[model samples]
Target: MSLRQTVAKYFTNHAETRERHDDPALVSHYYKTTKDKAMAKLEEMFSDQQLYDLNAISKEHGEISVYTKKGRKVFIIVTVIMVRPFQTAIDFSVTSESALPFDFGHSNKIIQQLYAQIDQHFTPLDRN
Candidate 1:
């Protein structure tokens, strides 16, 4: 992560992952699965989590919205994009709900944990 990103991650209540994120771990993740399968797996995974509540799911659009059920309370959006046949890229956005204006990197931590679970659930393509 760059100096700006590293500072902002701790100073803000929101953090997101994308295709070209400066942090290698936060880069968009590619999975060896079709969109339909990926969406299904994500839905199942999120729904099965005790800390997460399935807010909404749009298989057609490939977006899943969820909220934390305990602790600091947070909103998370998971996006799955099909780059090619059997190749899907997934990203995450997390926002911490707080009046203090910052969650002290909690949002980024949420994304990292979510990504870790996703990686464990699916076969990831080459990160490079």
Candidate 2:
């Protein structure tokens, strides 16, 4: 198998967004779904490679200035993990963030945006 597959099989999908805060069922479902997708991606990328070194590359914190109709505060955190590849000699970033909104709607958007950016950045490295 591959390292990515190994990670996917064990990855957690649950997301803790502000929108699902009130509903336990919805929150649980969100978490599982995200976890499953994330794990699948990891398994695809890292299953076979030896863990040469797995370490935190960097963590950046900043605010995204997206002015919506309702002013919502967003706490933007970006995490990067660097891995040493035994097979191809590559490095990549696995980024994630907590999109919590003081209100309700924007959190979902933030999470989706964050995931999309990470996916776009990482998908190519895994393919090669």
lDDT of 2: 0.30
The model with the greatest TM-score is 1
Q: Over 4 Å off in model 1, which ranges?
A: none
For model 1, residues 70-112, the per-residue Cα lDDT tens digits are 9999999999999989889998998899989999999878888
Which residue pairs in candidate 1 collide? Answer: none
Q: Model 2, which residues run further than 4 Å from truth?
A: 1-71, 83-102, 124-128
Best by lDDT: 1
Can you write out model 2's per-residue Cα lDDT over 14-43, one digit (the tens) per residue? 223332234231121111123233434434
RMSD (Cα, Å) of candidate 1? 1.2
lDDT of each: 0.88, 0.30
For candidate 1, the per-residue lDDT at 44 reads 90
lDDT of 2 at 29: 17
